[model samples]
Target: MSSKSLQARYEAAFMPNYGVPPTVLVSGEGCVVRDADGESYLDLIGGIAVTSLGHGHRGLTAAIAEQAGSIAHTSNLFVNEPEIELAEELLSLLGGDARVFLSNSGTEANECALKMAIKFGKQHGRTYFVAAENGFHGRSMGALSLTGKAAIREPFGPFAADVRFVPFGDAEALRAAVGPECAAVFLEPTQGEGGVVPAPEGYFKAVREICTDAGALLVLDEIQSAIGRSGAWFAHQLEDIRPDILTLAKGLGGGLPIGACVGFGSAATIFAKGDHGSTFGGNPVSAAAALCVLKTIASDGLLGHARTLGEQWAAELAAVGHPLLLGVRGRGLWIGLVLDGAHAGAVQEAAKAAGFLVNAVQPDVVRLAPPLIITAEQARSFTAALPGILDSASPQE
Candidate 1:
């Protein structure tokens, strides 16, 4: 079917949670995707940062196929080799003696982490949660309750009580909010949906100290910053501060669906048998795909590549010196191009017309999360075209 007809069909049949994009992508190779009209585009957002190795990665496909052929799934009732292997590999990369609880998405990982924190809190007679203002967690009840965006959370309330939000990047506010009554303090290493804002220097160190002093668990939501998206295995690793609980997803499974909540030290044993379980949490196929993603990243040195290219890409874009380009936020392939005016939606459309897929995450912030496998040539092509794209968009004065 043609792109227009497919979109019409989609609107007619599916829910309106996500408005339809102009293109109906049919296939992809590496960082490029072809729409139903056979037009190709460089996917700069990389399926919202989930397609780590990009489309049609041979190693990932092979791992999925091999695992599916042998053992595609195993219920939590039985053991699975791929699951075990992936867990061990993840813990090793995390540099912790941690236990992993596998799930299917970032929200699920966060949910699992919440459960651990609540359980741990109950044992200590604490019942409060401390999160950051403008932080986005997940849509699920518990996760949403912890999310500080009031517009989204207000409609969903009466949410779970005892959750407080402090201004993000404000160490004093965070210190005041977290204390003996708090069960856990959840914060993202970098705020992805909140316009790709990074934590200020030594902010995490202060948070760690506060959580430690308060005897509350520190849950780092690394969903968007983990799995080599930030040039580190986990973004928190760069700070050298260990969170009691860490949630990961997005690039974790390359393109397949998988997420995990890793618990360290005492938090590792917080969940007892049957405390929380999933029917297909750690299916062999997804586990295999994750394993392959890790292997390819290590062997290809994609982490260093992402870091170097991200720096170069940011510098090139800045050097373009476009009037509409205000500044850049974030690190690695995860970037937010801050525009001088409220024209991000128009810029996104213009970029799409110019054979590029970027996300206007906020009114003036364009998010770019290209695949880890993206070449310098591919990135440069977008950077070279960015000025024209902005001109076409016509930002307000």
Candidate 2:
């Protein structure tokens, strides 16, 4: 069917929440996808960084298929092998004495972490929360309350949590905001939705120290920066600091859906017999998929690959020296190409026309969270075409 026809059908059937999509993607393989019109484009954003193994990867598909063929769902009432294995693997990567709560999405993982913090803090007479400005936890009500962005968060107001917001990347501001009454401090090691911004050097370490001093929990949301995206197993580990709680999703299950909330130290035992649970929290299919992703990332050495590509791409993009370009920030595969003006939209459209998919995360910033398996030739193609794309998107003086 034509993209226009499918779009018309979509408008008639679905809610207007996401607005109109530019194209109707039919299929994908490796780092490329095809629209309904049968045209191909390099899939750079990797399904908002969800497709860690790229599209239709053999290992991921086989694992999902193998598990689905044998068994899929097993409610929390029963135990499953993959579920146990996946949790064990996550804890292993964390290198801590921790417990994990599995769920379906990043938001759910954050919700679980919030509940853990709340329960633990209430016992100690601490009920307040501290978060970073421009930080985005999730869209659900509880997670939304901790999110500092006003535009997407304010509309769904009257939230229950008493959260305080401070300027992101400022350790002193965070220290001033956090107090003994604070249950926990929620922050992202890298703020993905806030334009692929990385935490300032030593910022996480300072926060860890502050949280420890105030006897509060430190929760780091690594949903968008984990699973080899940050050139490390976990972004916060770059600073050699361990948080009380860590939430992960996005790339954890490759292309399948899975989320994890890992609690360490006192936070691990916060949940009682039945504080919270999920019907599909640890489906065998998703757990198996996650196992495959973790194994493949390590077996293939994608962590070092991502680290090298990130450095090379950042340096190359900066060297392009285009007039419309401002600078670059972020770590590993997650890079934000800053623009000289609020022209990221125009640039994104121009890039689409040139057979590359990208995200205009902000008016003046283009975010790139390509798959860890992205090849060198595929990356250079975009860098080679970026000058022309910028020229096409640049305004006439």
Candidate 3:
């Protein structure tokens, strides 16, 4: 069928909350995906940073297939080898004494962490939360309460009371907001959806101190920035600080769906069993996929590759000095290109026309989170073509 026909069928069968997808993706390999119409485009967004190793990775597929043929589900009633092994691998990667609660998506991970935070507060007679404005958590009730975006969060309203919002990257605001009544302070080391904003210098370190003093749990949402997406094992590692509770997902399973909520120090013992559970959170197949992703990322040295190539792409784009360009920020393969005006949608459409895929994360911000395995030659192709793409969008006088 054609793209139009597929789109019609999709709209008829599914809700329009996500809007009609622009392309009907048929198959993908490496960094390129073919639409139903047979046109191929470079997948620079990596499915919004979920496809860590890129499309159709041999090892990733093999791991999933092998695990599937053996066994796929065992529920929480029974333990599975791949699930246990995945937990061990994750704890090792995080490099600390922690307890892991597996889940099916980033929001579920945040939900687990949120419950832990609230429970910790209950123990000490506290009942409040702090999160960054414009930050994107998950969409579930508990996780949505921690998200900072008003447009997406407010309508769900009258959320859990005492939830406080602070300016993104402002240590002072965070410090002022977190107090004795605060149960936890939720933050993202790098704000992936808030135009790929990074924490200011000394911010994470200061927040750590403030949370410690206030006796509040520090919850770092690394859903989008973890697993080498930001050129580091964890974004918090780049800041040299550790959170009491850490939420991870997105790239953990490459393309498969899996998430984890990990607790450290006193936070590790917050849950007292029977408090929560997930039916298919870390099933054998997904666990195996996640294990493969972590192993491949470590052995392939994709962290350094993401950092080096990302820096080079930033420099190249900056050198062009296009009329719509403002600046670029972010680390590793996760980048946000800020435009002069609200022209990101225009640029995204133009790039799609030119056989490239990018995300208009915000009105004026274009976020690029290509697969970590994307080569320099492939990346420079987009960078080289960017000037023309920008010109086609909004040309200067």
Compare the candidates by lDDT and give the number of the best one.
Answer: 2
* Per-residue lDDT value at 369 in model 1: 98
Candidate 2 on 1-397: residue-level lDDT in tens?
9999999999999999988888899999989999999999998899888899999899899999899999999989999999999999988888868999999999999999999888988899998999999999999999999999999999999889999999998999989988889999999988899999887788888999999999999999989988999999899888799999999999998878899999998788889998999999998999999999999999999999999999999899888879999999989999999999999999999999999999999999999988899998898999999999999999988
Task: Give all candidates' CA lDDT scores.
Answer: 0.92, 0.92, 0.92
Write model 3 residue lDDT over 251-305, tens digit each, in one string: 9999999999999977888898799999998789999999999999989999898
Q: Which stretches of candidate 2 lie over 4 Å from their true place?
A: none
How far residue 2's Cα lies from its native spot in candidate 3, in Å, is 0.8
**Which has the higher lDDT value, candidate number 1 or candidate number 2?**
2
Ranking by TM-score: 2, 3, 1
* TM-score of each predicted structure versus truth: 0.98, 0.99, 0.98
What are the candidates' C-alpha RMSDs? 1.1, 0.8, 1.0
Q: How many steric overlaps does candidate 1 have?
A: 0
Q: Which 10-residue span in candidate 2 carries the lowest summed lDDT?
A: 196-205
Tell me model 3's lDDT, rounded to 2 decimals: 0.92
| Candidate 3 vs. true structure, TM-score | 0.98
